[model samples]
Target: MPYSDKIERRLHLAALVFLCLIPTFLLFARGAADVSLVLVGLLFLTRSTLRHDWAWARQIDIAVLLLALLMLVVVVAPFGEYPGKNLSRGLIWVRFVVFYAAISRWVLVDKLAIRVVCYATFAALMVGALDGVYQFITGYSLLGGQGMVANGNRLTGPLDRPNIGSYLSKLAFGVMALAFVAREQLGEKRPLAIGAGVMVPVLAVIFLSGERAASVLTLMGLVAVVIGLFISGGRARVLSIFLGAVGVAGIGLLLSSSDRIAGRVAALGAVVSDYADSIYGQLALMGWRFFTQNPLTGIGMGSFEKVCRAQQPPESLQFGCYPHPHNIYAEWLASSGLVGTVPWLAFVGIVIWAGLRLIRAGHTQTVLVALYLATLNASFFPFAATQSAFSNWPAILAWMSIGCAVAALNVFKRSCPTTA
Candidate 1:
C-alpha cells in the first residue's frame, strides 16, 4: 500500500520521472509536440503496468477527482467559437487528474517526487536562462523563445511575464526543501544551510520576475521559518545570526539592483503615483461588478476572461482584462461558482488537516507540508488561469502532496508507536 520495501513493493520511479519531463516545458510544445505529452504519459503508465510496479499505488482523492471531472465536462461541451480551444482546455483538466495520480501514486512520496520536481524546475530555469542570454546575443528567440518560459528576459532572467510568479512559486518550495535537507543531515555533514544561503541569488531572480504577490510570499515564508525555529526551542543566538545575515543580504541586494529590477521600483510607484486613479480604483470596481452581476452561479467555470473581456470599456485605462481574478478566492467564486467552490473548500480543508498531522508526527516529513503550502501562495493570490504552468499544476500538486504527506505521517506514527 505504501512505498515500504522494494521486494514486496515495485518501483516505477523511472516511469514517474518521465511523466514530469515528457509533456513539460509547454514552451517547446506549440502544436504537434503538445500531443507528445499525452503520448508520453500513456507510455509511462503502460511501462509501469507491464513491470508490475504497484509499490506506490493508492486510492485517488475522490472529491478533487470528481470536481475535476465535472470541470472537464463543462469546458468541452461545445457551445463556443473556439471548439479546439475548449477541447484543449478540457484536456488540460484531464492532464491535471492524470498528473495527480502520477505524483501521489507512482512518484512514491518518500523523497523521489520532490527531487524530480525540484530538478526539473531548476533545469527548466537554467535552460531558460541560457536561452535568454542567447536571445540577447542573437537579437531574437531564434526558436521563438519570447518570455521567461521562452528563455529569459532581456534585462533580468528568462521569464515570459514581467512577474515571475512561476519562479517565485518554485523558489519558495526550493528554499523550504533545502531547509528540510539541512535539518536532516546535521551530524556528519557540512551545514546544509549553506546551500540555502547560496540560493538567495536565484531567489532574487524570482523577484526580478516582478510578481508582487510572490515577493510578499517570500517574506512570509521567511517569517514562518523564524516562527518554526522559535517554536522548536532553537537557541535565540542561532536564530538571530541566521535572521540577521539573511536580512542584511536581502537589503544589500535590493539596494544594489535598483536599476535592472524594474517592477518593484517602477511598477508599484507608477501605479501609486501617476496611475492610481486607473489601476486600483478600476480593479476594485471590477471586483465589485463581478460580485454584483453573478451572485449565485457567479459566471461559469473558466469564464473570468470572457467576463473581463466582455465587461471592460473600450477606452478604459486599466490593463487588458486579465483571465483571472488576482485574488484566487474571488477567482474561484467568479468562475467555478458556488457549485465548484464547495468541493474546493472541502479539499483544501482536508489537505491542511493532513499537513498538520504530519508536523505533529515528526520533523522529517514536514518538508512536504512546507513545500505544498508555499506553492499555494499563488492559489491564494490567484493569477491567469489559462497559463497552466502557474495555476493548475500547483493546485493539483497541493492535494496530491497532501495525500503523500498524510501517508508519510502514517508511516512515521507506525515507526514510533509513541506518535499515536
Candidate 2:
C-alpha cells in the first residue's frame, strides 16, 4: 500500500478503537471519553478537509447549525446570571454535534464498524454487570473498592459512583440493537430469542442496580423495541410479548431476592405519593421558577446552583440545593429558558423523526435503529428524573446515542437495500 494509504488506514483504525472505548470511558474514565470524543471529531474533520469530502455534513448541517445558533444565543443572551460561564460551556457543547457527525458519517459508516462497536459495547456492559453483581453479592468489587453506593441500596458497578444503573440503562438498548443485527445475520431464526436473552439480563441488572430512573428508562426503552418489532410484523411480535412476561418475572425475582433493592423500589411509591414534597418535585418546581423568572433567556448554563443558592431552599424535608435541576427539560428551561429550549427540542425531534423514518422504510432486517432511538428516548426521558442534559456524562451518552442512530441507519441502508 502507498504510504498515504497506510497512514489513512492507521487513522481509521484509531477512530474505531476510540469509538469502541467510549462505553468504557463512560464507565471508568470520563476525561478520556471527552478526549476521545474530540479526537474522533478532529480525525473526521481532518480527513474531510484534506479530501474536500464534505458530503457527510449535508445531512447533519441543520442540526449543527441549530446548535451553533443556540450556543451563540447562550453566549450573547445578556440576561443570564453567569454570562462568562455560559459562554464557555455553550461553545464547547458544539463538539457533541461534531462527534455525532463523525460517528455516523466517518467512523460507523459500514457494517464492519457497526459490528465492532456493538460487540465492544456489549462486552463492556457484560463486564459492568459482572462487576456490579459481584459487589452486590460479596460487598466488594473486582475493581478493588466497595461496590455499593447509597448505603448499599445502589450498586456502583465499575464506577465509583452510584450511577452504574444509569450508565447501563444508557447503553442497554444499543446492545440489544446489536443482538437484533446479529440475529438478522443469522437469518432471523432466533431473533426474539436473542433479543430476550439480552433483555432479561439487562432488565435484571437495571432493576437490581437500585436506581429508579434507570428502571423507568429501561422499561421505556424496552417498549420502544417492542413497538419497532410489532411494526416489522413477524414472530417478533409474539416473542416480544413473551419477552415482556419474562422481563416482569425476572424483575419480580430480583425484587424478592434483596430487601435493600426492593425497599428502594418501594420508595418510589413514597416519592410519588408526596411528590410535591419530594426532592425531585422540589427541584422541578425550583427549575420552573427559574424559567418563569426569566421566560426568554434563562439564568445561564451551570448557573442553576448559583441561582438556586441565592434563594430560599425548597420546603421539602429532603430539601437540598443541587448542581442542576435533576431533569433534562427542567434543566434546559432553567438554564436557557425557551430561547435555548426550543432549538434543543427541535433537534431532538429531528433525531427521533429521522430515526423512525429509517426504521419504517425497512432499511434493516434488524431492530437496530429502533433500539438506538430507544437509547435516545431513555436518555432524555422527560418524566424520569435525571442529571442535567448539558452535563458531561449524560450529554455524552445522549449524543452518542444520536450518533449511533445515524450510523445504524447508514449501516442498514448499505447492508439491507430493500425498503418496505
Candidate 3:
C-alpha cells in the first residue's frame, strides 16, 4: 500500500476498534469509554482532513446542527441555575455530534466495519445478560461489587445500579441491526432461527431485570420492528411467530421464577392505577412547572435538580428531587425550554422520515431498517421514563444508536438494491 493509503487504513482500523469498545466501556469503564469516544471522533476528523473527504458530513441533517447551536445559545440564558455547568456542557455538546457523524459517515459505512461492530456489541450484551442471570439466581453480582436491592428485587448485572434493564433494552435494537447486516453479509440461511436464538435470552433478561420502563419500551421496540418488517414484506411472518413464541415463553418464565419480578409488575400496576399519587407523577409535574415559569430559555442544562429541590412537591404526594426529569420531553422542557425541546422533537421526526424512506425505497434492506427503526422507537419513545439527556453514559448509548440509524439510511440510499 502507498504510505498515505496505509496511514488512512491504520486510522480506520483503530477507529473501528474504539467503536467496538464503546459497548464494553458503557458496560464497565465509562471514563475510558469517554476517552475512546474522543479518540474515535478525532481520528475520524484527522483522516477525513488528510484525504480531503467530507462524506461523513453529508448525511448530517440540519436538526443536528440546530440542536448543537441551541446548546451554545442556552449557555447565555439569564435564568440558568448553574451558568458555569451550562456553558461547559454547551461547549462539549458538539462532541456527540462529531462522534455520531464519524460512525455513520466513515466507520460504519461498509460491510466489514458493520459486521465487526455488530458482533462486538452482541458479545458484550450476552456477557452482561448472562452475568445478570447469575446474579438473579445467586443473589450476588460479579462486576457490580456488592449486591444491593432497589425497588425490591431489581437486578443490577454489571453496573452498580438497577438500570441494567434499560441498558440492555436500549442496545438490544442495535444488536438486531448489527446481526441483520452481519448475517446478510455471511449469506446465512434460517434467518428467523438465528434472530430468535440470539434475541430470546436478551428479551428474557430484560423482563427479569424488573425495570418497568425498560420492559415496556423494549416491547414497544419489538412491535415497531415487527410492523416495519411486515410492511417491507420479507420473512415477516416467520420472524413474528418466533418473536411471539419468545414473548409467551419469557412471560411464563418470569411468572414461575419468583415473586421478585411479580412484585415489580404489581408496583407498575399500582402506579398506573393511581398515577397522580406516584413519585413519577410528582416529578413530572415539577418539571412542567419549571417549563411554565421559564417558557423561553428554561433553567439550563444540569440545572433541573437545583431548581427542583427549591420547589417542594405536595406533601400528600410521593416525590423526590431527581437530577433530570424522568421523561425526555420533560427534561428538554425543563432544562432547555421550548427552544431546545422543539428542535429535539423535530430531529426525532426527521429520523422517522429517514427510516420510512428506507422502507419504501427497497425490500433488500428491510431487516436492517426494521432494527434501526426499533432502536429509535425505543430510545425516544416519548412516554417512556428516561435518564438525563445530558448524562454521559446513557447519552453515549443513545448517540451511538442514532449514528447507526443514519449510517443505515445512507447505505440504503446509496446502494439499496445491490449492496444493502
Candidate 4:
C-alpha cells in the first residue's frame, strides 16, 4: 500500500479500537472513557479536514442542533441560577454530537468496524461477568474492593451498585445477540457456539445482580427477538422458540434460587398499589408541579434540587431532595419545559420510526441496535426510576448507542439498497 493508504488504515484502526473499548471503559474508568472518546473524535475531525472530506461532518443534523439549542436555553433561561454549572453541563451535549458524528462516519464507511465493536463489547462484558462471579464466590472482586452488596447480600460487581452490573449485562446481551445474528447470517458455526456459551454466564451475572428493571427489560428484549424470528418465517423459528423456552426456565430457576429476586418480583404489585406514596412517585409529582409553574422554559437544567426543596410538601420533604426527576420525560419537562421537550419528543419519535422502518424492511443486523436502544428507552420511561438522562454517564452511553444505530442503518442501506 502507498504511504497515504497506510496512514489512513492506521487511523481507522485506532478509531475502531477506541470505539470498541468505550462500553467497558465506562464501567471501570469513566474518565479514561471520556478521554478516549475525545481523542478519537478529534482524530476523525482532523483527518476529515486534512483530506477535505467534509460531507458528513458539515451536514450537522437538525436533531443535534435542536438539542444543543435546548441545552443553551436551559443555561440562560431566567429560572437558571447556576449559570456556570448549567453551562458546563450544556457543553457535554456538544461533545456527544461530535462523538456520534465520528463513530457514525467510521462505522458507515467500513463495514467490518461494526463487527469489531461487537466483539470488543463482548470481551469487555466477559471481564465484567467474571469479576461478578469472583465476587459471588469470595465476597470480593478480583479488582480489589470495588464490589457493592445491596439489601445486605445482593452482589454488585466492581461498581457501587447492583443496578450498574445489571445495566451492563443487558448491554452485553445485546452485543452478544448481535454477534450471534451476524455469525448465523455469514454461515459460521464456531462463533455461534461461542456466543451462546458467553451468554449463559452473562445472564447468570444479571440475575445475580438482582436488578428488577434490568431483568424485566432483558426478558422483553428476548421476547421481541423470538417474535421477530417467527415473523421472519424461517427454519430458525423452531430453534428460536426452543431457546426462548430454555431462557424462561433459566429465569424461573434464578428467581427460585434467590430470595431477593423472588421478593422483588412479588413486590411488583405493592409497588404499583402504593405508587403515589413512594419517593419516586412524589418526585414525579414535584416534577410535574415544576413544569406547570414554568411551562415554557423550565426551572432550568440542574435546578431541580433547589425547586424541589422549595415546592415539595412537608411529607414529601422527608424523602430529601433529588438531583433531578428520575424519569427522563419528567426531567425534560421539569428542567427545560415544553421548549426543550417538544424537540426531544420529536427526536424520540423519529428514532422509533426509523428503527421500525429498518426492521420492516428486513434488516436483521439492525435488530440488535434497535433492541439496545429500546432497552435504554424503557429504562428511562416515566414510571421507571433511573439515572438523570442528562448526566455524564447516561448521556454518553445514549449518544454512543444512537451513533451506532445510525451507522448500522446506513450500512444496511448500502448493502441492500433495494430493501432499504
Candidate number with greatest lDDT = 3
- Which stretches of candidate 4 lie above 4 Å from their native place? 1-8, 51-54, 57-79, 144-147, 173-193, 310-316, 362-382
Clash totals, every prediction: 8, 0, 0, 0
Superposition TM-score, candidate 3 onto the true structure: 0.89
Query: Across residues 1-420, which tens digit of lDDT does each residue of candidate 4 receive?
Result: 887667777888888888787888877877878877887777787777667776764443535445645555553354555566656666655666677778766643453765667767767777777788888878777764755565545666766556555546446544544454455443334544665676676777776666666666666666766676655556657867887798889888977887777887777657678878777787788889888887877777788887666765545575888898777788888877777777677666665565566665664544444454554454444466667877777666666666655555555456567755
After TM-score superposition, what is the CA distance of residue 198 in candidate 2 from its true location, in Å? 5.7
Summarize candidate 3's per-residue lDDT along 1-420 as a digit string, tens digits: 699899988999999999999989888998888888989989988998999987656443644654645654654344577778877776676678788778878888777787677777777778788888888778878877546477447888888788788878877786566556555554433432454565766777788888899988887777767666666555776767676676667777877876887888888998878776687776777788999998777788888877766666534335667888788888888877777777677778877777766665566666677778778877787776788878888888888877776775665566545432
Q: lDDT (0-100) at residue 214 of candidate 1?
A: 54
- Candidates 1 and 4, the one with greater TM-score: 4
* Local distance difference test values of all predictions, in order: 0.47, 0.73, 0.75, 0.66
How many clashing pairs does model 3 include? 0
Candidate 2 per-residue C-alpha lDDT over 251-284 given as tens digits, one digit per residue, 9 for 90 to 100: 6787787788779877998898888788899889
Task: Give the lDDT ranking, best first.
Answer: 3, 2, 4, 1
In order of appearance, the predictions have TM-scores of 0.67, 0.88, 0.89, 0.87
Worst 10 residues of 2 by lDDT: 186-195
**Between the candidate structures 2 and 4, which one is better when assessed by TM-score?**
2
Off by over 4 Å in 3: 1-3, 52-63, 70-79, 185-196, 228-236, 312-318, 362-365, 417-420
Candidate 2 stretches greater than 4 Å from native: 1-8, 60-78, 178-201, 230-234, 313-318, 358-366, 414-420
